[model samples]
Target: MDEISLLEQGVSFVLHIDQHLFALVAEYGAWLYAFLFLIVFCETGLVVTPFLPGDSLLFAAGTVAGAGHLSYPLCMAVLLGAAVLGDAVNYEIGRHVGPSIFSRETRFLNKQHLLKAHAFYERHGGKAIILARFIPIVRTFAPFVAGIALMSPVKFLSFNITGAILWVAGLVSAGYFLGNIPVVKNNFSVVIYGIIIVSVLPVVIEFIRANLKK
Candidate 1:
């Protein structure tokens, strides 16, 4: 599909995840678990697929679990595993590709993003791995940059595991607890949009700050 079409579909999916999620679970049954795993994996694992819905998807999954359509434990486990393993694979790819590939801009990957990820890594140290988990685009690029920078494998894995647990479990739990509230449930589309805005807010602020500096 074209870029605009893909963008529209992504927006629709995020806004209506609550509506579609239960139907998917019911129709796919246990396979839905594997599907979610793949979604989470591709979102983090592939640089070009960074635009995939990660945060909203997790929240929707948790909401489904809250409604008793799926097991919370199983959902969390599969998602958590996908997230950590995804980062691991991404890091390895970056390590293998080295930093040279990022020297030039591409249709899918931007050199400026790599620079930002590098600066983020430098400023935050290993903690960037954890912090990036909460950010949108940065979350996808952080591990790859970490590998390109040749961060110690041991330290990277430690932060990766910790971040995955906190990110996956924390967001999922938030949805489980807050999603069922009458107000939240009634306006979940708004909540999903809010989540998207909040997730990207940091990047927006950073961009503005950089422009001001320039």
Candidate 2:
């Protein structure tokens, strides 16, 4: 799918996750926490899947945490572990299976595109694992690209951990802080959009910068 279509899917998935959070909290609260953690992992780890919610889910989970319906520390731990491990797993996959994946006749993915991702990841391998924390599509695909390029595990780990901690901390804190206000508490959907824009801001800035330089 196109970038716009993928973004729409991301928003839809996040909204669905949010709408179901109350029921999820009621029926199987702890499991829902794990479920959300897994969703974040898959969205960031798997190159073929960007449909899962990332920013919005984290923020919503944080809001729930502040309400004391969920334990904030526990949620933070689960999500942090998931995000870090997910990228590590994807890095391994790209290292070993990337070529085979590129050889396949997939409509949405191409070997040339994979090479481009690889080169970009190579030139900015450290940032691939770090800055990706802020970008939507880049965050989802960056690890996969790193794998394709066989980035050093030690280097990847260093940057991956840093990014995971900062990304989770920032989003969760935003939820914890802003979620308490009367306006924010009532208009949660606006917060979701704000998270998306924040997530995309880096990409938008880079795009503008490249244009200005040209």
Candidate 3:
């Protein structure tokens, strides 16, 4: 497929991840674990790929595990590792070159998103590392911003590990426990949409609050 076609397919897959994940698990079996790891890693690790699925992906993985197609402990471990490692890489990149790239919005980098993440980090301090895990774009940039601000490695790692554990375990557990229910199963797409909305709701509120002050 061409780039545009591939991009379209990717967008569709993310939007309907609950369905696509099932197909992935069925076709790839054990390899699905690696796929999940990559998706989680890139989504958290790369600044430009924030649009990738995170919250819904975990939840869908949990649901798959709940169906006995995958192992819960293994899923949690792989995803948690991916999340932490991704942030660590992103932090390092930021520490090394944040100033140069952040000077202007490049074709790939969105300066506004970085600024928003920086503002969040400023307001919440180290806690933003934990809180940003639940927010979409902010989570992708929070660690990078932290690195730019010269946050200590020990402190960033502590918060990064804690946030990854909570983010993976909480959402995955929710899906494991609830995703197979008749209501959720029949309306899986709706549930994914709900998860995305809930994940970004804080950002929406923050934006509104910021505008009100302006």
**Candidate with the greatest lDDT versus the true structure:** 3
| TM-score of each model, paired residue for residue | 0.94, 0.84, 0.94
Q: Which parts of model 2 have CA positions greater than 4 angstroms off?
A: 1-19, 102-104, 108-120, 208-214
Q: Estimate the TM-score for candidate 2.
A: 0.84
* Candidate 3: pairs in clash: none
| Candidate 2 residue lDDT tens string, 143-193 | 888777777889889989999999999888787777767898777777777
Q: After superposition on all CA atoms, what RMSD does each candidate show versus the true structure?
A: 1.5, 3.5, 1.8
> Of models 2 and 3, which has the larger lDDT?
3
Give the top-scoring candidate (TM-score): 3
Candidate 3 residue 149 Cα shift, in angstroms, is 0.6
> In order, how many clashes per candidate?
0, 1, 0
Candidate lDDT values, in order: 0.89, 0.78, 0.91
Pairs of residues clashing in candidate 1 = none
Q: After superposition, how far is residue 153 of candidate 1 from its true place, in Å?
A: 0.7
How much does candidate 1 score in TM-score?
A: 0.94
